[model samples]
Target: MAGAGEPGREGSGQEPLLVFRTMMRRLRAECPWKREQTHRSLSRYLLEEAHETLEAVDALAAAEDAGDPRRRDAAASHLREELGDLLLQVYFHAAVAEEHGDFDLDDVASGLAEKMVRRNPHVFGPDPVAHDDATSVDDAWQRIKAEERPRAALLDGVPATLPALLLADKALDRLARAGRPVEDLDPDDLGDRLLGLVAEARAAGADPEQALRDAVRRRV
Candidate 1:
């Protein structure tokens, strides 16, 4: 039996997206500051938004750990604001590209959806050697990624601009997955062991940066 109203209760379900796109276009044309900006000029704002979002995530994580509903709600509210700021940066970029007749938000979204379907063959296409193990999925994902983009080196895409710790984590993970050999550097002390611990965390499907950040928040 069908529900009330129309067969499709929602009226096209694209009105909100259309509204957002219209708003972005109007802002691009009418706003003086927005009119003057280019994608290169907005790069810093994108980075700033990303860092603010991460800060909010950290705060939310800490609040969740403390088991305080009030604090959690407050953090969630702040996080939502940060996410909106971040999303605006994305839409702003899309609007800028659209002005030049290059591409728009739809192109960005379509490319991402296409990439996800291509990479996650197990879920979108066929369940190739299905297993609940995360490591297996990760391994297959890396292999498929390598095939999708032929890299000159295993570390080709590991951006040097990434924070030092994150770059290390990526390099380690890529080398390990690619079966590339690394020089056996001896761990001489406690600091070296901490480096090894980061690798262990990656192997266990944990984010070392977030883990340390959470630990600091909990303890200090």
Candidate 2:
């Protein structure tokens, strides 16, 4: 795998991975507060940073819609700051890993490199797959993944902590992956079900999240 600051440049001469490492090292050495941070303490910051990044993306879209170049630059600046905040979480995690002699940022990066190569056999192997045949690559990726975690169930990988809408999407996706028959839902019936739920929520003056939580609590 390529090191962060290797020769032969792209875009800028600086490598982003190296830059991240340098920032991490500086934070570790120069900042007392940063040095004292733990994974638990940094969790909220990571979530906040991710939301900020999404907000910046939204701002960029709004700016483009309004034809405002200045807003574009402001949005870009916000994006950079948000990304830095996210990187800080990585740095904090790496520091914790280093303390425990588990693994550091480098190990994380190298593992990613290995996974990428393993997933994309077309790029790394002699029998490169045809570019037009995306299904072939997808099949290969799934087969390789199954081999890697032989004991894991089909639905084991999706996180239970995701938002309800996202979790629903993931659940549906996993079902599709397991070759479940996709019988078409009647749009009129689906609309009626959704509208009834909305009406019930409004009648009860209920927060949808709380209602969903309650439903989930009962089911689980």
Candidate 3:
């Protein structure tokens, strides 16, 4: 099995991604469900696939810890299938856009490649990284991204669809990084207070969800 991000040999000069796109094209033309799918309609499956991929990750970790190659392989296979489904969602959306005379998959790939180079200054730019310092590298990444995509507000770009704890944590982190204080919003209910506590945890550099889970587990 090829590890993640490892390049594979081209199949007789046929680019694997292009081949996959061609397969997607055929499916769009022949498959009734695929033909009927729009970007909006496929959103639910995209979310489901992402969650399933996360589940596969957890299973793979457990399999590896158990030192069972067979179980690990099974977990890897499940992950691959889920990832393929997710990839299909990308291709499906791009195909729909292409049919409407908008941008296609090539544009998507090209833009991502350009962004990768533009963002990774330590690797692709003049400021090369001499030693691999993961922490410092991440700081550079966030700095570069901040400059590339400036937002008017600190938490303006945070995704609303993210898990509530994650969203709260991210928003709080952004506010803290920007030297902005989190105003003590009046809690209307227990949920709001929990969210506020999550933000407080982020401010204090703690994991609120893990802390809560640990506390609950002690009672069990």
Candidate 4:
């Protein structure tokens, strides 16, 4: 095992990802806390790290908007740290699985790369797809996904545990894609009204979840 600062075995080039995976494996073996963690146990940390990364993204955007070079640099560093923390969750889960003879980080990464190549026919396939714009590209991607999971329900892969606003946004998007868009709005009912707002946000090309978070932040 290589020490933190010492790059081990000259002439054997070290990739950061492989090094990180090795570090995670060692942590799982030697660290008491990491040793005890299961996939179920690490779920909360994963979620928390994801949200922290989001916050770091917002901060970086704000710093850029403010035109502060120093602030932007600091924000970028914070975002990178947050991203690394989130990635730790991934490697942690992979290490846990590797221990049980399930899967490892390489398996997870390879599957993702394969999925991206499979989905983006315009970029990687033998017969390239012609997409005029981002919307068309997204449409093509969704179509490929649908074909891959034939006979799946509209909400089959949509997690019910998503934030209410985001859940409504995805549900509405699915309905619109299926040509069963929710045209009827009920202002009197809170849920329907909120869904309507989410639809409006979607049309305006905004993230309702982040918009609401910003609004609440301004209020407090």
> Which candidate number would show the highest lDDT if scored against the true structure?
4
lDDT of 4 by residue, 56-169 (tens): 998898799889999999999999999999989989999999899998777998999999999998999999978889999999889999998874688989999999999998
Q: Rank the models by TM-score, top first.
A: 4, 1, 3, 2
- lDDT per prediction? 0.82, 0.70, 0.78, 0.89
Instruction: Give the count of colliding residue pairs in each prediction.
Output: 0, 0, 0, 0
Name the top TM-score candidate: 4
Each candidate's root-mean-square deviation in Å? 6.4, 10.2, 6.3, 2.6
Candidate 2 contains a number of clashing pairs equal to 0
Writing each residue's lDDT as its tens digit, candidate 3 over 92-210 gives 89998888889999999999999999878778888777536775777777888899899887767788877777777787778767888677667887877877888778657687765
lDDT of 2 by residue, 66-99 (tens): 7989988888888888888787788778877786
Against the hidden reference, what TM-scores do the models get?
A: 0.84, 0.67, 0.77, 0.91
213: Cα error in model 2, Å:
20
Q: How accurate is candidate 1 locally (lDDT)?
A: 0.82
Off by over 4 Å in 3: 1-13, 129-132, 181-220
Task: Give stretches of model 2 more than 4 Å off.
Answer: 1-23, 133-140, 182-220
**How far in Å is the alpha carbon of 189 misplaced in model 2?**
9.9
